[model samples]
Target: MHNFLRFFPVFASTLGVVLAVPLNVSHTTISPAPSPTCTEATTTALPPEQDCFYVPPNGWETKEPGAVLRHRFAPQQPFATDTVNYPAWNILYRTTDSNGDPTYAVTTAFAPKDISTPHAMVSFQFNYNSADVNESPSYGIYHDIKPKLWISKYLQHGWFVNLPDFEGPLAAFGAGHMAGYATLDSVRATLKMSQIIGMPRGADQGVRYAMYGYSGGAFATGWAAELQPTYAPDLHFEAAGLGGLFPNGTATLEKLSKLQMSNWAWSSNLRSVMIGLGTMHKKIREVITSSLGKPEWDWNTVIRRLPQEKEVSRLDLKNAVNTAINSPLVRNVLDYDTTLGSHGIPTMPLMFHRADTDQLSAPEDTQELKNVYCNSGASVFLHVHPNTWDDPHFREGLQACLSEDIQTFLATAFARRLYPGCGTDNRPWGDHQYGPIGAR
Candidate 1:
């Protein structure tokens, strides 16, 4: 592990030189229509409700998964600070649901205008962690500072960043399979639309790919890695970086339900999970709503209206936590979606960054995940951060993006260098005095 870390600076410099020279591939530029179909001329900004772009065209189901159904120049976001004015597009593409039924999803693709040829691509999944369609990345990314900062690093590297609304139109937050399908299919759509995004035609096959996510986003990234071998065998990811992972949704929910009694914030987390699961599975919804009694009739009403209102008060969330925790059917649905190892092991190298004191996701769960992947002969690197005074979950996620180790991992993968074998680094960041604890 130490040897690999020592080689990163040299690899990174070589990668920069390689990326500077555009690929010697044929190019064909396609002009975007001045006025895209299904767009309202009067409205400058179209939310999902009024945006016909979110809806699939007729016969969309006949198209193969990841096929781009419709695309248009994305409306200018107030918070979008692209000084170079990179070409950005809102793409509607074919994808599948958690049940393997044909469906469509939207992805926001940002391309570096200076790059004439395809380079590496990063399919970044956001942790909106909500059941509200309005809060999806396609609509909310520009407004949020954290995501913008996280995405800028990749864009600055001249890599195409594909941000998919992985929760789908329904915003089924906890449905890992659905998120996986949306994520992988988003990559396909980005590749298919390369020419339109200022890359050469047929450059999709030449592009290196990677995936990154944290917290709820990691839930999708982990599933995408696990499902890639079978679901999207044609695509290959050089590396995947997951931080603050929710390894088991069932355990997370059960833990949240028990803790919510004392903490108001935990109740909010429980409500979000319950609403997200209810949106995906009808049986779970029935069980949750059925558990609500006359005393909590208002709580039931609030849950029913959450999709539209997209807000819940602390009091309302507190009233509903018990209703979901006690439902067997809800637990059954979560149990089915929670376990990551039930699916096949990932073929790509994986980097996991976790904090020992993460409040939302238990550190033990991440250890178990690493053990499962290592036992199955998958390459894994686990970096453990020491406990902190502040929220370790949020801090660890931030540290992941800013860490030198993460940059080295991505650089090593993109350069096609030999990745370190399965190992664990328990030393805190900047503690270079000690070598990695567990190297195999």
Candidate 2:
């Protein structure tokens, strides 16, 4: 593994940011609109803000979770390749929210033209890192080239790729259970609609599924893994690759508040998190307003708006972050909702990796989670990258994408192999089931 690190390409450039443009989109249900007609000219056209495909039909809640509500041939966006060879579809499905209430979400499925029998499937979560529904991969995937390239790699391997907007329609970004439900339901929708999405017959049963996510994406993946045992017991994952895992919400906010002075970007991220969390938990809004006194702005309305809106002043952002961190009521809600590892240990094997010096998510938190899983008898392989750069958070994330370690881990898991060369100086700890190579 160390030898592979030297060959990884340097990705010093930052990812492209999706410009936030406010739109008049509604999350509530409306009268059903006609189905979309997918002509060659309309295939590449972006979905309008009021695209009826997103609106759940009346009585949609009566359907079971993971039931396909609507689906359309999606635009081959973020990639200018031939749609015939790499077809994609947008699926709106019924899923539960953080409160376990019936809700709806969307996911994009990409597949190779000729899928092999008993092929592999990868649920690749993208790190959109925003609290805006417009920034979701289903709509804004065309803005970033990195996610497109990653999706293409999986397609090149003849694996179906499922990209879920795990934040749901409300864009409740930091709500762990909601993200988990959406992620798992997206997979369910893909498998349930296998034939509709052009998969070979009986493909669902023979498909070997794995998941990969980094940074904010990892937050969703981690939560889904933890919640899969009870929340979605019908589903099973061959392996899960979680890099730069966000373990504790409170700890993360405290770390960001301390670093916000040096990097204004960190302050922006702090504000986004607060808004994301506030969307799902009313306690967060109540505590912030009570601790800081009623602000000139309406907390309820503000939480519904986009995070990048200038309506929120810098002073308000600072005060909200401080109140969220200090107030016991807000902290309790965050501890229960935003944190990972409290739910349950995943049954599938996990490949965990992170930089030794990640600024956003502390290294100790990842190690602590690994300890919890290992102690619970779960198969886990923990890899710690060397802190060679100033911004290990970004550099290590790029390394995860550039290196073949994740692919190798998934392949080993798909093959039901016990060891995938996980033991080394860099990877000092793994569960007994996946012991060090050559230790049998």
lDDT of each: 0.69, 0.71
Worst 10 residues of 2 by lDDT: 16-25
Best by lDDT: 2
Model 1 lDDT, residue 262, Cα: 69
Model 2: residues >4 Å from true position, as ranges? 1-44, 76-78, 82-85, 114-118, 201-205, 290-294, 300-316, 419-440
Per-residue accuracy of model 2 over 344-392 as CA lDDT, tens digit each: 9898878777788888788788878887887787777777776767767
Q: Please list all clashing residue pairs in model 2, or write none if there are none.
A: none
| Global Cα lDDT for candidate 1 | 0.69
Residue 313 of model 1 has an lDDT of 45
Give the clash total for candidate 1: 0
Candidate 1 positional error at 361, Å: 2.0
Measured by TM-score, the strongest candidate is 2
